[model samples]
Target: MPFVLYLLGLAVFAQGMSEFMLSGLIPDIARDLQVSVPAAGALTSAFAVGMVVGAPLMALLSRRWSRRTALLFFLTVFLLVHVAGALTTSYPLLLVTRVVAALANAGFLAVALSTAAALAPPGAKGRAASVLVGGITLACVAGVPGGALLGQLWGWRSAFWAVALLSVPALFAILARVPAGAGDASGTGVRAELRALRAPRAVLTLLLGALVNGATFCAFTYLAPLVTEVAGLGEGWVPGVLALFGAGAFLGSAAGGRLADRGPVGPLLAAGAVLSAGWVLFAVAAPHPVALPVLAFVQGVLSFAVGSALISRVLYEATGAPNLAGASATAAFNVGAALGPWLGGIAIAASLGYRSPPAVSAVLSALALVVAVAAARVGRPGAVVVEPTR
Candidate 1:
């Protein structure tokens, strides 16, 4: 394991922390700013909307440049956005900054994933992806807990300030280390790249990720309501349980990486099963205190474990266009991000039978599993950068 990989990991860690920390502190911000909870909470949604908007735009715009330079600019922009967030007093202004930061983050992640793939030593691409993805998992474990504590103590403003400060160390490390420059043109043109991505196998892999992530989030985004409303848990206890769920997620990512290294298909298949099982359990036993943690742990693991394999699958298909493939995956993931909340919200609104969400999610996961299984049958093992044999 080279030190450079660790530096890239730090960049990812810091960026992830910034994005996720907002969720835990929304209440604090809303109260402090004298705004509605949804108004204050719009910051999180703004960030996702930014990612949805920026993922493809930034990837395509930066297509002509070296990934390193493009990624560096993205990181720099995120740093500035954090600074603006820390300094802003107006709610609308703060939302704008979050949007800017998120846009930069979308581009940063796309480049970082590809760079990590290119940088990985022979036969270790999965490990490199793990290191990068681990940052996201670990952010939930660390960032949410730490931010909540800070918001409880000093105030929500203090938390953003902390993120701004951490940005300095992360930016310094990524720029100083991590050889990120791009290379001479490979003769594979953009049109050819797009053509390959439209292949049935490639589209299936993307949709699998999209559906799985959507299903997971359909359950996750409303986890607080699920815990409080369904399980009859107190509001005060919600954060603690969420922390436990984050821990379960970290473990899942670790196990998933190890399993994927052995074979991506097997772990993906297992995760999809786990996802379906978890949702069923959640739908059935959500009211039981013991079952809450049990279901949460399972869903956390399955949701992200399969995500690790999805990255490998996307890269394998888009060998000629690492940036494009990586960006498309990001877009798909965000699309699912948007879809889950919408789907869950609708279920809740319609007075559909109780447990409709997790039940629906189970069906979505089952479909994703089917797609993944079909995909595994066609592709060769490992993250092979398959080029058209001339």
Candidate 2:
């Protein structure tokens, strides 16, 4: 509930914008760089790959640093990368920038989540985590669109310039607002973190987090095709439907925070259940014009609702090393991000139809629910209970 949480959220918003804005800039980048569209698309893939590798590596490297310092270090690197991206003319240089930016982004996010939990009131880590992650959802709603518009009005480089500029306010806020020594982990070395990673319950929770993300992205990555080809909606309607999903995400994050603060298990189980049913319903309703938007919104809501609880659960189980736990969750989530789309693409390639993605998503969601149930049974005999202090 501290104001510093909001400040950290601002930093996250900048990173989120950088991650997604590339989608809207692909054509512009290709034209400007005189590269193939697929080559330009590789930039996005590079960022994602960097995240999966950077999360754990940064946590390991920064195990002895305070969270605030880690955040500042990464954010500064991120800002510089964007500046280089904005100025660079060489296609290879741009690609390198993207990868380095993603590394900084991954480090910042892992530290930020753990820092948010560390700074919150004893019982409100879930709520605090939500507020931190909510910035990413808000970026989906606001930052991406704004970046796209800016790129259209100016150029693709304009978006990078804007993102770099945005980091300034976030830097100032972090320096001025976040107290020193707030997320100190001086004595907690890589050995302690490695030991934490060896715990069975901690590993399960990390995988559960990954599965939860896999379930969401399975359908989401192919949403455009689902809306236009399957639902029979015009291309113009795509933005509106996506906007509805973003709005739902914003609201869902706030609601999830409250629910997660109470306990992690209920929110995890409920979110999984609703998401499973929603994806199944989406598969059936893919052809209905009215139903597509409704289902998209519901999917967005349920997909993100488990985020706070998942982070909180991991932090709890890895009491010896919160940063590593957060980094593991980040890596797991990105793994799911990469895995879900591949699985959905396989289904589509097999002539399973556009509706196949949601069907795949449903199965994944059901599997995630099973994982959540098992995760809930990890620490306690009766039900999952998150004590105030791990």
Candidate 3:
């Protein structure tokens, strides 16, 4: 179990590193590719779109396979495509690679979570899911900074190559540790997986993922700008701002997981409250760097807190349709990722202050909280989550 979990973490680390490496490298990419910074940013968008397109397709394709086999295939594409992203020189090709690589990454992550759950001991599935997702938490804790440094010192391509290199070792680890013939996480047949999607509970879980992610993106997409233009800080401070943000993210994620184990709804409520309050703070602090850190820390914690709960909720609800539920969650996150940045960008372009994005984000979080509460009110024994402590 430890070996497989470690491999899953490695895979997630690679994915997280790949997704965020571009954050610090966008300027370099623009300069080298002879495009505007906004254009360079398109690569990030393309990766997200690919996740949307690829998630469901891959999930469907792997219906007949065990979660292990499905994951292995997904990572094969995941590793190679990232290497392709590193090798490409043409801007268009780079965009294509980003899309393909991220699609594979999306599918791979869903499967990793499923596989981890399958491997868990009885009555500790939440811990298992947390272990799978810990990679992203770790990425926030360390991978982003490390990737950014590589991008800063070597080049953006080198950063991608570093991510690709990490994959080689992870792939080898997966091949060595994971046993064959593992069952699906939910023990549902392929046909049952399809049927589970029709369940209202599954649908609600997906909506929660989308709404929460949308709020997360809205507040965070403009973080750099919020800390700079709004606070009148120089670019030199960007690294520190991001680092602090990541630290907050790490703390929040760890705490949230424990909270979810105690009561699923508890963590969700706290996170949504933090999101709303954090955004309000952003609105007030846009002009003050000192205030930004306080908000940023809370922002990071709240932003990342939902994922474990959401993924677990969907998986638990999907019952007969675990794969589909997993894939749907990925799609929902992509939707949020897309919606968040586009809205934030538009707000920025319209001469709205940086606070505008988080303000908008606050509204979305409020909506998510409302939906979560509604789900609780409906209170179907299995439909509304209470999540007892371990």
Candidate 4:
């Protein structure tokens, strides 16, 4: 793998920290802004909504630009948004900043995915994609918790400042290393790209990606409660458990990438099946103190293994529309991210215990497995061919 891939991963880590660190800063933000905690939490939701909308839109708009240009543009915008967010006193302005930051983040991610694949040596695209995914897992492991610590010591604004600073090195590295013409649009026009998405295999693969991610977040979004309330651990154990899960995710990403390079369908089907069963086991063992951490790590491994493979598969299936392929995958994952927590919350509201989230997650994973099996049966593996737009 080229060192530039690692630079792209670094950029992703900074953006991902921004996405998740807000959870730890909600109370501080509410107090500082004189808003309710839920209102403050809306900032996170706003970012998620922006990501879902921005990926495809930005990809379409920037398709004609060189990948390096698009990436630098988005990273600069992201840096500026965080600085603006840090300095803002008005809650509404901060909310606007969050949405704008998310837009930039989404665009950069969409572009980076294709750029990584383009830059890698032939037959190593899956490993390249995993490098990017590893950045997110690393963010979960270190960046988010470090942001929380910064918030605790200084203020929530400090975390924003830190994110902005982190973007500086990524900006310079991308400028220095990423090839100028990498991931340049194929001249297929937006219509041809849109048509590629309509293929039955591509559609099913996208659904599979969403379901796999939804299952992950369904359980993950409520992990703290499972650790403290069900497993009888103290609040202090939450961070360690989350870190353990993240470590597993990082390893899984690397392993999945290598597996995907050989072929995506076989590994995806196998991992998806095990992931579904893992969630069921997780739910059953939630109340056992020793079992909770062990299962959390195992589930994290299985989840990202499936996720990385599905993403690589999506990219392969949409080869005719390279730019849109990455953006669509981004949108699908975010859609799952949003829906999973919502579903888990509903289960909790219905008087199901904290264990219910994992149970819900199990169902979602099974659905993903079903979709994967259907996708495998539908289309021959590899990119769909589309006529060039005249």
Candidate 5:
């Protein structure tokens, strides 16, 4: 494997940390800005919105540019936004900065996925995708908590500063490691990319990715409450439980990468079924202290295993549009990220318990399984046979 792949992972780590760290910093931000907590929380939503919209847009705009240029531009934008966000006292300005940072993050992620796949050896693209996804799982394990600690010790602004500083190394790495002309598009315009997306197998694959991600986030977004309220654990236990889940995700990504190397369909079908069952089991055993944590870890493993494979599968299905495939996958996952929490929140608003989120997740996972089956059938006979390239 090329060292540049790992550098892309490092860049992803910084972006993923920025995406998730706000959950722990919202209260502090609200107090400092003299805004309501919910208003401060909107910053997170703003970022999500940017990510959902920016991935494809940025990818299209930069499709002709070299991967190195696109990455450098995005990272520089991300770093500057964090610096601006940290210095801004006005809440609206901070919100704007968050949106801008997320846009940059989305662009970088979209480009990085293609770049990784292009850099990997034939039949090893799955492992390359896993390397990138591993950065996100590792961020969940270390970066988010570390950001919270920084917020606790120095203030939320310091966390922003830290994210800015973190991107510096990745910026330098991209300059030194990534080949100058790598990931330059082959002149397949936006029309060609859109046509590729219209393919049945590609559509189904993207839907599967979205459904699996939705299911995962539906449960994950509410996990802290589930642990405290249903499992009867204290606040202190939350971090440990979350860390356990992150550890599971990291392991799952590695395993899923290997599984995907042979074929994505079978592993997705098997994992999706087990993941749905696991969610149901989790909901049923939510009140059991021992069972709850164990189930959370298991669910994490299954969910991310499906997720990592889906990332590889999407690129494979959309091979006709190499430059846009990564962005499409990013959009699909972010769409799920937005929708899953809303669905889970609806369940809670109706007075359903914290366990209800996992139940909701189960339904989403089952839907994903159905989509995966459909994708497999569609891909069996006349699959596209384009190689990934920069």
Candidate 6:
């Protein structure tokens, strides 16, 4: 992998830390803002909603520009908004900042993924994607837990300030390292890209990506409560457990990359099946202290392994409009991000207990498995299977 790939990964790490750090801050945000926990959880969905809206809009706006240019612009907006979020006194203002930050993040991630793919040597797309996605996984391992501890010590707003400070270096790195004119549109125009995305096969592939991500977030968004409430752990233990989850996710991304390099379908099927079973075990055994860490790690591994495969699948399916494929995948992932937490919040509000989410996640994972199987069937006997560029 080129040094630029790591720079892009660093950019992703900075952006993603702000996004995923919210899971740890929710309890504090709820307490400080005088809102219900469910209300605080909605902040996660708001960020996702912004991503859902921002990705395609950024894609359209940046169609004529190089990805490095788009990325710099997006990171600029992200940096400014994190400062705004840190300073805001009102929840509504904070929410607005979160949304805007997500818009910027969406643009950054969409372009970054495309840029990474373009930068890779032939047959290395999966590894390149992993290096990029590894940013988020690494954010989990370091950034989120660090943010959680920072918030715990100084306050939730301090975490936002920390993220803002981190972004400055990332922005400089992007300016210095990411090559100019990387990831410009290959051959497709806006109309042609839209047409290719509208194909039934492409749409289905994107839906599967959304489903897979949604299933993961359904339980993940509520994991904090599950840890402190169900498992009866101290508040101090939350970050440690989250770190364990991140460690598992990191391993999963590496293994999934190797599998996806060969092809994502097999890994997708295998991960999906394991995820379904894992969620069931998670829901059943999460309350037991002895089982909590083990279950959390297993779930994280399966969830992120599927994520890598899904991204590869989306890229493979969008071969006709490769530039738009990363944006489409970003949109799909955020759509699930918004949906899962919103649905999980509903379940929590209804008094279904913290365990309810894993049950919901189990159903969603099963659906993803069904989609994966269907995709395999669809590719059989005379059907074209578009494997990622190797």
What are the per-model numbers of colliding residue pairs? 0, 0, 1, 0, 1, 1
Residue-by-residue lDDT tens digits, candidate 6, 292-361: 8888888888888876666655665666776777789789889988888888899999999989888888
Model 5 misplaced regions, further than 4 Å: 23-45, 87-94, 152-156, 374-390
Report the backbone clash tally of model 5: 1
TM-score per candidate, chains pooled:
0.84, 0.84, 0.89, 0.88, 0.88, 0.95
Q: Estimate, for each residue in 1-390, the C-alpha lDDT of model 4 and write its tens digit.
A: 888889999999999889867655665788899996446656766786788899999988788888899999999999999999999999999989988998898899999987877777877777888999899888778876677667767888999999999999999999998888876766777888889887766776677778888888777767766877899997567667777777788888888777666743555577778999999999999999999999988988998887776666667667777779889878887777767766776787778877998999999999877755654566543222112221
Residue-wise C-alpha lDDT for candidate 2, range 1-390, written one tens digit per residue: 888889999999999788766545665788899995446656765776777799998877777776678888999999999999999999999989988998899898888877876777877766787886688778767776566567667888999998999999999888888777877654667787789877776776667667666766667656656767888986456556656666677777777666555654565577678888988999999899999999888887877776445645676677787667678766776666656666776787788987997899888878877766765566431113455434
Name the top TM-score candidate. 6
Model 1 over residues 78-193: C-alpha lDDT tens digits? Answer: 88888888777889899899889888988887777667667766656556677877887777678766776777778777778777777788777766664556421244677877
- lDDT: which candidate is best? 6
lDDT of each: 0.69, 0.75, 0.70, 0.80, 0.79, 0.82
Off by over 4 Å in 2: 22-45, 84-95, 148-158, 232-235, 264-267, 345-354, 374-385, 388-390
Superposed by TM-score, candidate 5 places the C-alpha of residue 93 at a distance from the truth, in angstroms, of: 4.5
- With candidate 1 superimposed using the best TM-score fit, by how many Å does residue 314's alpha carbon deviate from the native? 1.0
Candidate 5, residue 303: CA error in Å?
A: 0.8
Candidate 2 backbone overlaps, count: 0
lDDT-wise, the better of 1 and 3 is: 3
Candidate 5, residue 305: CA error in Å? 0.6
Residues 177-247, candidate 5: write the lDDT tens digits: 88988756677777888899888767766777788888887777677668778899875566667677777
Ranking by lDDT: 6, 4, 5, 2, 3, 1
Worst 10 residues of 6 by lDDT: 381-390
lDDT of candidate 4? 0.80
